[model samples]
Every structure is written in C-alpha cells, then in structure tokens.
Target: MEKNAAELLKKYLSGQCTPEEKAMVEDWYLQLPFQKKAPAAEQIEASHDEVLDRLKQRPKTRGIGYLKHIAVAASILLCVGLGFVLFNRKIEPMAGLAKKKLEDVLPGGNKATLTLADGSVVDLDKALNGEITKQNGIVIRKTENGQLEYIIQDDPDAVSGTNTIATPRGGQYQVSLPDGTKVWLNAASSLTYSYPFAKNERAVALQGEAYFEVAKDKQRPFKVRANQQIVEVLGTHFNVNAYSDEPMQKTTLLEGAVKVVAGGNEVRLKPDEQAKFNAASTELVVDKNIDPDQYIAWKNEVFAFNNEDLKSVMRQISRWYDIDVAYKGKITTEKYFGEIPRSANLAEVFKILELNHVHVQVSGKTMTITGN
Candidate 1:
C-alpha cells in the first residue's frame, strides 16, 4: 500500500478524483479482493496509519475477514455516492430513480430499407426471409439471420443498376454485395452500390458508418466514397465512419492495405492503422498502431469509447437509441473510457452514465443532460 495508492483510493471514495484517476481506482479496487498477494499490515501502516490503527482496535476474531468486510462496505458507499444501488449482487438504479419509473427505450436491432434500381423502397424489417426481389440475374434475399444478400446468376442480358440499402436511426443491417463483399452498416448509415459491379471497378458510396470485408478482385479494385474521401483497396477488411454530425471522417484498416484519398491528398494505410480525414482542413493524417476493434465494436454489438468526450458519446447514443439530446448549463469535460453492450435498454445505459455523475432527464424520445 503506497501513499499515492491510498490517496487515490481516498479521493475516489470522496468522489473528488479526476476521470482518469477514478477509472484507475475503480479498476484497482474491484480487483483488490481477488488479488493473489494482499499487502502486508506493515505496508498499510506505513501508508495509512489511521486505517491500521482503527483495524487494531477491532476483535482478533475479525482479522483479515474484517478487512474484507470493510472493503465491501467501502464499495457500497462508493456505489451510493455515484448514484447506484447494489441489489442481489447487481448494480441498479437508486431509489429516487426507481421511483421515477423513467421510460425505457429498447435497443436497436436489424432494421433497414432497400431501394431498388426502379426507386421502389422495401422495408427490410417487414420483408420476409426469402427472395426479396430479382433484378435481371441478381437475386436479392433476406437471410434468416437478418442479412441482406445478393446472389448473381449468369445472365448475358444482365445490366448493372444502382441499388441502395439504408439503416434508419435505431437500426442496423448487414449486406452481401453482388461481388460477394460483406458490409455491416451502423445505425443511420447507407451503402449504395451497383447491382452488377462494372467490369473494371467495384464502387460504393457510403454515408454514416460501415465495416467492409471487400471481395478479392484483382482486375477490378474496390472503392468506397464517403464524405468527400475515397478508400481504395483490392481486398481488405476495414471500417469507415463518415457521419455528417461527426467532426472528421475516419477510415481504419484491419487487414491488407488501403489508400485513403481526400482533396487531392492521399495516404496508404497498413493493418492496425487509421486515417483521419478532416473535411475542413482537407488534410488526411494517418495514426499508426491504432486499435481497429474500437472502431468496429458497434458492428460486434458494443459501444466502445476510448477517451471519448461526452458529446460524442451522446451522439452515438442518440443515433442508436433514436433519441434527440440537448444540454443545459455547463457539462463536464471529463473523457469517458469504457464499453456498454448495445443490447442494454435506454434506462440501463443511462444508469451507467449516472454512475459517472452524468445527470440525464428522459422525456419520450428526447434526453436532456441537466448536469454532472
């Protein structure tokens, strides 16, 4: 037990630690009970003399077990200070929150709309899990797993036509292109591609965010155009986030290679690299040693935030939960780092935020951040 560690724990208990310090203290404290080697009493005495003296006054029968009980009590106090109540070994809303009975919004799921070449719209959510439509020799079907797939049949008379698949707010969808490329569209995103890819190129226009597993075709390169930026690759696994509301467009490579071009500026990316394109400055910058999982976590049914700002986190929440967000007064500048399951209901997600001292008021489809 170092002096610094004791000080950090004290700050965390009193809710006076910084965001980074809070995260560190919580992580360490949660694992303290299960640590293989507990610190010696002498170490505690050296760091926190008052705590050791208080422990010594207790009965000998309550030795290490008494310390464990103290740890549990401290944890409970920490939880309460952070607006959480421990119930049956689970974290739940405080009594005040429970009494409010806030309206719970369900999480997003497989939902999208498919626009045919003829401008006909098909709601994928209501469409049957079978042949959705047949255009020329291309057979579009909705799989049982809620994936929209295209099967190309050999037809000499087949002609290429443009088709678009879009996911509305609180929705997401997966699609397999005519060229066998797999795409996972995030909430409020769209992907437009040719029914039968042109002979010399396979191109798609993307809006919002999508993760792509491009099919290999040496003769025809795969290109994704998003927010005035283009990502070109023969075959690669990558993710692109080009939401209009976001400050910058991001392209992260997971495998193979990709060349991101924007405003006549270009940068080639290797695996584990991310290219950030700023539309305002028309500058394309590459970040090395990036973690691709964080960018693609949404596709895997999780919301991963790595030192993200509160506004950015709320934007993702608004899109996925189909809600509008507004802020009042000054908000905390603390950066958040964690993951929340996409399956969690709105109330559950807000509870997590409350644990971080973010106060939110939910009214129908809108959420207002009152304070922190």
Candidate 2:
C-alpha cells in the first residue's frame, strides 16, 4: 500500500505510533527524507500556529483507527507548538459566521422522545401540540410553540416501567425539564425520563437524538442513558446522536466534561470534543476537531456543514423538512461546504445547491440530486 504524508510522519515519530500505522507513515516520510519538510510547506516559524498545525496533522491521516484515536487527543498538547506560529499572521480578518440553509448538517442524523410515566407511548411526530390524552397517574402538556412538557404529580410511589417520548418521521421538538435543562429533540428520536425522577440525581434515558443544556447541580449528577452507552455528568452541555439507522452513536461535548462508556471501555471527553462509538463493532472513537458553530447550528436556527458531502447533506434535509430524497450516482464523490439560515424558504435552500453546481430539482416534498 502506498503511504501519504500522514503515514510517513507517524512512522518517523518512531514506535510512538502503532505498528499497523508505521508502514503508511514510513512510506510518506521516505519520499521527503532529504527535504525534512512537506511539499506544501507553510511559512517556517516556531511562533506561528500554522507551522504547529502542519506538524500535528502531518501524519494523522495515516490510517488513524480506534486504537490510535487516543493518540491525537486534539490540539491541547499542540497549542504551544501551534501558538508558536498562529495568531501572529498579519492576514485580513473575516466575518465571524453567516447563516446556512436546511441542506447543511453533519451526517449521522439526530434523536428525541415522548414520555408517559405509566409506560403508554405517544410518538411525537404523530402527536399534536396541545392536550395529549391523559394516561394513568400523569398529565401531558404540549406547548403551542411545539415543545413537549410532561408533568407527573400522582405517581408518589415511583413508576416501575419507563414512558418513552419518541419522534417519528418528519418531526422535531424541544423539552425544558423541570430542572431547567433544555433539550432539543431531532426527528425520529426518543428519551425516557426516570419515574418519580431521581431525588438526588436527575437522570434520563435517551435514544435517537437530543441536545442537553443540563442545569448545574453539583450535588446531583445528570445521567443520560443511550443505546449501549451511558453519558454521565453533573452539570454540563452536550449533544448526543444515537440513531438506530447508523451503527454508531456519537456524543459531542460543547462545554464541560463527559464520560462516554461503551462496552466496558471508558473515554473522557473535554469541551469542544466528540466521542463516536460504533455499536456494531463496539468501538470508541474520539474526534478532537469540533466546530461548535457547526455542532450547535440547530440551537441557533441554522444549517451548517463544515465539510460534508451530497449524500450526507441530503439525509439531513430529509430529516428537517420531512421529505424523501432521491439522487443519481452522477454526483459521486462531490463535497458541499456552506451554510444557510433555517428560516429560509425551501427555494433558498435549493439555491445554495444550484450555486455549487449540483443540479438539483425540487418538486413539492420530493427533491432529486443529479450531477457532481
């Protein structure tokens, strides 16, 4: 197998890298042994961050796997090296961030749920915003703004079974927990709140998709139980996307720390980091490069894809607008990188794609993608 710059650098770093990765790195570094630097060289300086960034990513693409994931550990360690060269460049400043369209969002999709302490279930997608038919020992109140708020007063003895709040196709909702923890539920997701709720610790069961801004309570930790994995925290904000369609479940931390437990393995994630778990393989991965703006786009009411592709982007649009997407293989290996406001009309969303030269035709609720 041929090795790239990433592979070469990993091997040049010695046994510091895994044996499986050494070959790829050795090949790339061997090509530039005499030059000592990369072919696409940046300005050389210890004080410039780009220099350090190049140094860090120099060998990252060399077949980085789960076993080697803990290897990179984000830019925390490389900050000093990156700081040496970054923030000192005399380049022109740009706008902070602009709004994006509906077609933009990271792949892997989202989740949400509707709960009844009695165990009876109501799919959020099928349920209307208003009075949900009452069940045993519980009252369901759907806000006009489309947030599902459940109130349980009669269950003094604590219910045994869990009441699930799930979102179906073409659905999205938000929840403000009693503790003031705001959760945004994406399409086709569900979460179960503990019965009578924990007195000391505020815990909840989650599946599909949800983002949490946990109310700070040091005395009682907030626990989110997802498929196969458990996210434990006291007071922190993070996003968990555990869609059943995909074999992987991901938890991205925007602020505060979170411990992702998957298959007896535990990985701690810091702020601005994401932990991706493969359920089929029972593997845990850590991606350090997180764009909070991109991750929290839904919160701010926008669609943002950092560096996503056509298929991935299409799925996101389907979830948000509740549409079926069809595309031919003509647009193979094409990438879309842009943002659009969520409030924009569907036409506006399609315009972004047209501008990128991806011929798209939208009719009613169905849109097809053709051409690269």
Candidate 3:
C-alpha cells in the first residue's frame, strides 16, 4: 500500500498524472491513519529535524516549474511530520474523539446587566427591545440587536444619573453611552459611567476587556479607568484589557492619541501603539507599530492567536465558554498559531486542539487538560 501510494503521489507531482490518479492520491493522503500508540518525544524530534535538514538541502530554484514540486513536498511532509510531533507531545493517542459529543457547549453572546442609579438591576438578555426604563428624564432602550442605547430627553431640571453595564462569563454586550461614545464590552467585563455626562469630563470605569470609540468632544476629555490605570482621550479609538486574572493591563490605541497613567508612570500613545502596565512595576511599557486589529478582533467575534501559548489560549476559551480549566499535571508551554471562529462549539474547538496533541476531558462545565 505504501509503495502504490508513493508511486501515485510521485506521478501526481510530475504534472503528468491523470485526473483519476490525482484524486486517488489526494484521498489516500487525506485518510492517513492515526497510529494506535504515540511515538516517543525523542523519536518525533528526530523525524522533525530530519525533515528540516532534507528540505534545507533541496537546491534553490527561481523557475516557476519547480514551485509545484516544492509545494507538493512541503504539504505532504508537514502533514506527516506534524502527526509525529503531536503524538510525541501527548505521549498517547487521542481517546474519546468520537465520544466527545456527549454534550457540546456553545459560545458566548450579547448578554449583560444594566444597573440603574436607584440600585435596580435589569437583565439585558431577558429584557425586550425598546424602552427598558427611564431615569433622569433619559430613556433607556434595548435595541433589536441586543445593544443598549440611551435617548436623552428635554428636561432642564433633569440630573444626570449613573449607570453600569456588566457582562458575565459566556456573554458580551455593546452600548452607546449618554455622550454618544460607543463601547463594546467583552465577556466577563463591566463598564460604569454617569449618564448624560458631567459638565467638565466624561469618564467610564472598566473591568476586563472593552473597545471604545470615544465621541469627539474636545471640550470634555474622555477618560477610562481600568483598575489603577487611566486612559485619557479626546475622541479616539482604543481597546483596554484589564482582566483581573491577567498579569498585565494593556491599552491599545487604534486612532488618535491618548495619555495612559498607571503605576505612577505616564505615556502618550500614538496611533497603532499599545501600552502595557504591570501593577508590580512603576513604568508603562509601550509597544509601537503594532497591529491594533489583533487587540479589537474579539469585538468582531474572532479568536485571533498569533503564536500564543497553550495557557493563554485556554484563558480565552475559559472565559468564552464559562468553563473551568484544570491541568492534570504541569501545563504545556507549546505555542499555537491559528484563528478559530468564536461561534464554534467547545467540542469543535477541542477537535482542532487534539490535532496539536492536546488531550482533554470535558465533564459538565469543567475541562481537564490531561496532556500536551
């Protein structure tokens, strides 16, 4: 079977293969069988090194004709080599792959709580669209898209009231503050602000993650307080990640400029810059010329990972799925590179992770990371 498959693949690579023969080779590759037992780490590492050395020895060519051969070889080698890498990492073949469907957990959606100044809490998820309540002569309505919007009324005596919106784990929400500033609160986040804005400044306190589009009001500076850090802006776009569990708080600027104050330090950020604040340190580290889109990708319902480690990736999964994560032993430091749609179920996500040699067991709302 190996000899026949190799012959077919070789013919296909030569560009002289028939359509039926090409299809046969593709089918064989796609159905490559998984080994019942995993290979040792050293053996897998040797295979990986061997593949790299062989590829590096191949003669370089600028001719387009050589491109197809290189592509074919690279594709086939990656599949076979990656399989070995995964097997070695796990130290055991995947189990319950076919039985992971006992129950699948769905992703988060727009759900939050709206706390009025009177200390009344309304569940936005259960509230009907339009006219949830009225306070300080301002009308609060739940939009058709599950967003919370404010409508200011004409009342000279009306005093601006404070309100808070909070999203629990497995939830998200968007809101248009009384000053027209737009905010998207990520899962396990909250935003608190005074409605109708005060005369001097507009401020909001945030916990967890949020993307903000500050309504340009040069007269009133927009300030967001996330823990001990404060980001002051004058009509700009930015994202703030202040999850309590995270090691550092990050404020990324997408447009305009902002002054970040944290840990007895301050920095003015330009466009496409990220300021990181560690509570233990008295300095703000700013990363310039970064892709701000990566910071705000969650607002678009995408889990974007760029060479992220397993623990960091799982942290996001835990919040989005509202599941507890436990490692059977020492956690893996393996890095992953890929993007997964936020709409995928927990089972679907685990299936992809399994390809990377990550073994997991899901029971109720708990996920045990058994290996790799």
Candidate 4:
C-alpha cells in the first residue's frame, strides 16, 4: 500500500494522473492548513509525523479503496513538507532558514513619475499629497490615498498639452484622467494624454500594461494606442498589455465593446473577450470567453497565472521585482497555474516556484532560473 501510494504521488507530480486521481490529489492538498510562515526546523519532522499518523488512523472501508486513498494523501503531504525542507537546505546552508528571510526582496508599491506639458517631471513617490501642479486650466492633485487625479476647470482660451504618467520597475500607480477615466498602470508602464482632451475624441497612448475604466461620452470615443494597435471604445472597461519584450500585444475587454485595429486588420471584442496582435506577423486574433480577472489581477495586488508558460511567468516576476532573469539551462515547458499575493517577498515566491521544479537563484538585482 505504501509503495502504491508513492507511485501515485510520483505520477501526480509528473502530470500523468487521470482526471479523477488528479482531482483527488488536488483536493487533499487544498484541504491542508495554510501556513502563514515557514515552519521551524525542529517542527518539521514532528509536523510530518503528526499528519501521517492522523491519515493512517482512518478506518478501512470498501476493501482497499478507502485505505488506499488515505495512504496517498499522507504521501502527498509528506512529500511536500520534505520538499520544502530539502529545497531550503540545498539553496543555502543557514540556521533554520533564517538567512533566507534576511535576503528576501520586497514587492512593489505605488510609485510613479508625472511629466507636465513643459517636460518638467515630478516624482510622485516624493511629492507631497495634494495639488501637485496646475497647467492650462487642469488641476493635478495627488490624493490622500496616493492616487493621481485631474480636475478640469473652465478655460476655453487655455490650450492643453500632453502630460504623461510613468511607473518604474517594482512600482504601480492609479490616475484619474481629466475626462474622469480611471487608469491603473502596472510596473514599467506609461500613459500619455492631453489634458482637457480633444474636442472630437478622447485618446491616450499606452506602453507596457494598464487597466482602464473609460468615462462615458457618446460624442467622443475613447481610444488607446499601443504597439501600433489602436483600441477604440465608447465607454468600457478593458486592459492592454503592450510590452515590447512580449511576443504579442493583448487587449482584453471586461465590459462593453472594443475594436482593436492593427496593420489594416480589425477585430471587435465583446465583454470577456481578448484581442491579440502579433507585430511580427501583423496579424490580429480574438479569443472569447476568457476570465478577465486573471489579466487584471496585478491591479488588485495578486499574481494570477492560468496555465501560463514559465518564461511568461518569469517576465511578470522580473518587472514586479525589479530583477533581471537569466536561464542557465533549457527552460522547462511546464505550465504553471496558481495565485500568489503580489505583496509576498521574493523568497516566498521562489519557494512556491521551487516546489514545481523551477529553481531560482537571486544575486543582487538578478535572478537565475534552472529547470529540474
């Protein structure tokens, strides 16, 4: 029975489990108590023993079926606990993983820079909350909650110029545009727009990634230009990821409708649909019925990966942690699926990755990944 349990666990790890078996293993894992912090070295073995004993005491029923499942569950818990300990020991030789805590990299926060029409820059991180500046009948204020807000004043004679807001690596920011549109910029992203907007339309240019809640104005359509693609909408909620490092630019719509135009091709996206544009091919593709929440998870302070590839996952980590990633060996093709808080330190995030056979070594502002 023990040998059978071990075999089942091995199969589960190697992605060979049948649907029912996979569900069973995952259910058992999810039922385990969540640990707020890593367990001490002394508690490791004792905790393992207690959990194993509890699983073993379950009454036998329906021949080998009941006992077989209990044994498998015990093995899964044992393997996970042991893997955590072994990974810590292999990564660093320190007293009970204490050294790892000290070397951890903290997560990102609200940090950005605002560039006025005259090209003067203000570091939002250092600037005091309240009226940041006024230009051409527009009042720029940094709110108490650290958000940037624009208040438009009546000045028909004023000529509005372009203003830009940018966030550096390991940073993010929220801004309310002059037209009442709210945008949340992710790390290493920028948004540029004219204050007071144009008389005919409301338009903005984006780089990197941002989530937008457009203000309703039937006469003036809102458009976002990124990566040679333009997303046009009347009033909608959507997200755009147009990082130059990425293979494709994606525009995801959460509500209302949007049309993505690129390279003489256009695709209209309904709610919960995503339009992907690849610059290399100059082709646009539309995917329907995707969960919009996963794309905007970062805005909500969470890292959500839905069967995402390793390189893509690392790209997100690199931007948010302000680290450079290099591969030592052939990258694994394994797809990762999970949600980790954006607030977790680098070490905690790496620990989760290590469990899935993706190892990371941190040095200064760089991270090296080696696949098992």
Error of 1 at 158 (Å): 1.3
lDDT of candidates 1 onward, in order: 0.76, 0.59, 0.73, 0.75
lDDT of 3 by residue, 179-233 (tens): 8889999999999999788888998999999999999998999999999899999
How far is each candidate from the true structure, as Cα RMSD in Å?
Answer: 10.5, 14.3, 8.8, 10.3
State the lDDT of candidate 2 residue by residue for 209-233, as single tens digits. 7899898988888889888999988
Q: Worst 10-residue stretch by lDDT in candidate 3?
A: 82-91
In terms of TM-score, the best-performing candidate is 3
Question: Which parts of model 1 have CA positions greater than 4 angstroms off?
Answer: 1-103, 355-357
Tens digit per residue, CA lDDT, model 1, 97-206: 53253345788999999999999999999999999999989999999999999998999999879999999999999999988999999999999999788889999999
Clashes of 2: 26
Model 4's TM-score against the true structure: 0.76
Mind giving the per-residue lDDT tens digits that candidate 4 earns over 1-372? 122444545677789987756654444354232323322334434445655565456332112222223332342343332211221122222233433742477898999999999999999999999998988998899999999999988887888799999999999999999999999999999999997889999999999999999999999999999979999999999999999999999999999999999978999999988998999999899987466788888998878765567788889999998888888867777554556688878766655544445556656777777765
* Candidate 4 lDDT score relative to the true structure: 0.75
* RMSD to native, candidate 3: 8.8
